[model samples]
Target: MVERDRLIAALEDATHASSIHNSQPWRFRLVEGGVAVHLDPTVTPRTVDPVGRWALASIGAVVANLELALTSRTGRAVVTEITLGDSIPEAADLAGGAAYGEGPLAVITLGEAAETTTAMTAARLHGAIKERHTTRGPLLGGPPTEEEWAELQAAVAWAPGIQATPASEPLVRSLLSLTARAEDARQEDEDYLEEIQNWVENEAPSGTGIPRGAIGAPDAEGHVPIRDFTQTPMGSSGDGEAVFFEDPPALLVLHAASDTPVDQLRAGYAMQRAMLEATALGLGIGVLGQALEEPDSRAAVDGAAEESFGAPVVVHQILRLGHPAGTITYAATPRRPVTDLILD
Candidate 1:
């Protein structure tokens, strides 16, 4: 009964984690020992997220919330049983990575020791979960200081499978150009435009989709590489009004050790932690995910990040970070109730 209560509370907090389009593609089942995280096969967005990269990452974010919430709520260490092993599993083990997408990515169970280290970290971050709002608009202020940057970078060290590389101005330009190309292509596709807009709710009280309040206008100067939800289905930009987005946009790329389903989840795990940390630091966060969703742009991201970091890596996620132009507290995004998200 005690375990059931902990799982219930943690699951509630975990549902607040990020997902593409607020798709809420994950489901949970109460197993004998712990709660099981499952990816609902039908929920993957065929047009926008054709490759399911964000789906895997979305599951990973949920895993992160569960880990933090379990430790934060109970103030104790928890054991997470995942498919990952001592190291990156072989290709045969990954089996093109799709093999595991339909099953539980992880099982969260109670553990013995009260490790103060993770407990403290969890307490700090878990509190920020509710405070996090994916800022889609322009961030006004400048970048982080060396100290702040280091602290923000440290959040990803929760696991060894992922590394965070801050983008230089030149690198940022190149990456954004690639991202803009993809965004342009998406804009041209009426089907994709319709699909994305469906997720963008112009009204609030959104139960499980991107609310209208959450959607911001494209950069007036077309400088930032943000996805233009403001685009209409008839192939036009929104409102004839735009704002100047911060240029050389503060960017951070998350690199995973390999391109596997497990690695994608690992990158997301770290991404969520860093996002929570950024929120704690009073930073606004945006995603340059369009760059990662296209093939050519994806390769450029991988090559540029590898050159920047001097290592072989898979580019999984990119974040644009800075102080918000407006309120840091935007409206809450849509999310299904925890009770509704659980599997029978």
Candidate 2:
């Protein structure tokens, strides 16, 4: 029972470590030797993530963090075989150095917990895993403190292929402008608009998808920049319109060279890791994948980011990183019960 409680706590820590549309999409079950993590395919935001790639990617982030937290505790994580029975299993007897299998679906075997895993270490990071949330509000004036930024950069060091950098002033302007342009362009596509609207409106208060209060009405004055899923009538007034900040102090972009599911998963993991590192440093990070998700917008954003960063932009997600104007509150995103997601 104690072991079950430990695994449950670890599962919550890892899932909370992931980033979605503030939509947490992971569930876990305590098995004989370990826990199995399954995706709530039914709850996925198909409108925003048509292929379930982002959802899987989010799960991958949870997997990575879970593995890290588990291993960091015991120095080794162990189990039996990875059973890909509908849902992905988190524990298995697989080696740490092995790569994921090539397929739309795969499972991983976690080794035994190493002796290095201590109560203190796990407790310290435990708080970080549970408390982290993405901040989408605006930046104020300057960049984050040198120390904080350095710490963030260091946290993602495990993710070798992904690159993270703070957006410069000119870079920020160009990215925001590009994002806005992308939104305008998306308005031209009725299907895309409908899809996005469905995701925005259908979300339960704590379930998947972006919430109405988090997104402001497009025509409202000083609207905090967010994806306009509503495609509302041009002049319609709604709660979607609210100004949180005039200009954000910093923006962070995560990019990789490869576009494989594995790489996307890696990027998601790195993004979450960096976000938690930022939270630990008293900084807020918000994801803005609107432009990155659209084809034309993707090209523009990629080209501009590539030019600025001096690297080809395989941009997976865009994040706003800065301090919030005041204490921000967030609701707990819902998760399916483990019994529902895991197969026997």
Candidate 3:
């Protein structure tokens, strides 16, 4: 039987998983033998993620961390089954309203595996949980060594419905242009600005939202445009000298066979696993969600993915990978306490 205390500890670690804008939109319930991960609709970034793609992906990252934590402890692999639009009792909807268009994002069950097997599986990756952070600062260095790239490729191969394709230099340049256009479009929408502002609290006491310090200096001349969360001066890190991404940064386009909530969840699982694997390989990682957030941009990315993989797939996430410039330090983003995330 899974010990409740052990499960709680794993859940706590899972809370450290990455999310869109650090929204951290997830709730957990200790089920019969495992845990159910739900999207906290009230906290969901409706403006930026109206379809809940990013939110579902964030939930998958949490599941990845939870499973990793459990296996590290029990030496047993965890099983995750994602169900979309599964209805929940009115009383149980933490958002206090109809659940988001698609009800719960996923229900992860702890599966049976020998402790030794699980331990062996998690031994190499266990340290990445704490070490991994979404790097928004300027990325230096050339690219991942052949072996490093191979390890990253191997990490997400087990995720069933996701595909990762490295973007070529020409493709990366095109994506950077598309991302700028998408971000400019979002900037013109006042309502979208208002919604995003709510999560950019410079002095957020709850320790769950994006802090100003976490926003890296924007790279104006760089190929990709990092989201400017500091437009309002919410104590965001002051803009520094414009850094240029002269060499093509290591980029990966993550896509799914189909564009569905469940597929998005699987994409999230693959993304987090790849990020952690990159961390283990001493690579800094950042996400370019703008490229896949809006309709036009998303379609463009889909075209890029289809061309790169020679298959029809829906792009879900774009990752920027490379080594951090010099010894520049990156502060960890804040997360809500595990106590606050648990649903009774």
Candidate 4:
């Protein structure tokens, strides 16, 4: 069994994993195997994540952090289980043991390490946990090198059922179009606008929402379709003048074998692993979640993924990577304390 203090420490770091709208919709409890992660539906956004896709991804990020931390500490870990239910009869039949319910999404079992051989990569990624912030600011210093992109691909390789591919110029253009269309559609919905307004904390960081400083300045050229979070009045532009985002935006799409609950969580884990790898390489990262939020655009994103990867895979998330334009500092987004997140 894992030590109590170690588990607590790991949980503390795991909270830093990215969540949609900064809504940390995850809960953890100590189990016989290791730790059982549950979905906290109370904080899940009803407007954006209608079916808990992104919510499960958020939990997947948490699982990534936990695995990295525990493996680094003990040099051994087996992610035993993750249950994101599939209610669709055929899908449920295909995804064995994926029962839909209030059960835990994943259980990470740990073991002692006699020597530190397998944990080298784990330790490296674990070190990047605190450094992984959602960077919406324009990333410069030119596009990441091929070596850097290769490092990210290696990270994705560890995640079974998930694949990451750099988008082509045409595909990037298509995805950007989908994002812009989705953003425009989102802004029109009163419920969606209200969700943005409610989650954006203008003055200071709260226990849950994002601060004004963290939301990056808009893209001056209007090339990147960054989500505008400063919409208290509904459709209000982000604060500060816009700047030019990196040209030929380096976009990576995380895809899965099928659009099932199991695949969604696995892709989420891969998403965090890739983020941590990018962070380790000193790369700024941003998510184009809007592209996969709307139904039509999401299907289009799926099609684009199949075209890029040369396989049948569903689009789970799109990430933007680049070097920061300058010394960019983001206001810290708050994470629920381990005490608050841990179940009794």
Which has the greatest TM-score?
A: 4
Give lDDT tens digits, candidate 4, residues 1-344: 66788778888888888887887777888988688888776666667776667777888888998888877766675565676554433443121122233678788887666245557778888899999988887887777789998889889877787888888888898889889889888877888778778787432224788877788888889899899886655458565888888877889888876877777778888999999999999899989988687678899888876776677778888999988867768787777778988888
Stretches of candidate 3 off by over 4 Å are: 85-104, 115-117, 202-205, 233-239
Off-target runs (Cα >4 Å) in candidate 4 are 86-101, 202-206, 233-237
RMSD of 1: 3.5
lDDT of 1 by residue, 141-173 (tens): 877667767877898877567878788887788
After superposition, the stretches of candidate 1 with alpha carbons farther than 4 Å from their true spots are 1-3, 84-101, 201-206
Error of 1 at 44 (Å): 2.6
lDDT of 2 by residue, 67-116 (tens): 65665444455432323333333453112111222222324444545445
* Candidate 3: clashing residue pairs, number: 0
Query: What is each predicted model's overall lDDT from 0 to 1?
Result: 0.77, 0.59, 0.74, 0.79
RMSD of each predicted structure = 3.5, 6.6, 3.7, 3.6
lDDT of 2: 0.59
The segments of candidate 2 whose C-alpha lies over 4 angstroms from its true place after superposition are: 17-19, 22-40, 68-123, 139-142, 200-207, 211-213, 216-224, 229-237, 244-248
- Which residue window of length 10 is worst by lDDT in model 4? 92-101
lDDT, residue 200, model 4:
79
- Clash pairs, candidate 1, are 201-212
* Number of the candidate with higher TM-score, 3 or 4: 4
Q: What lDDT score goes with residue 50 in model 2?
A: 47
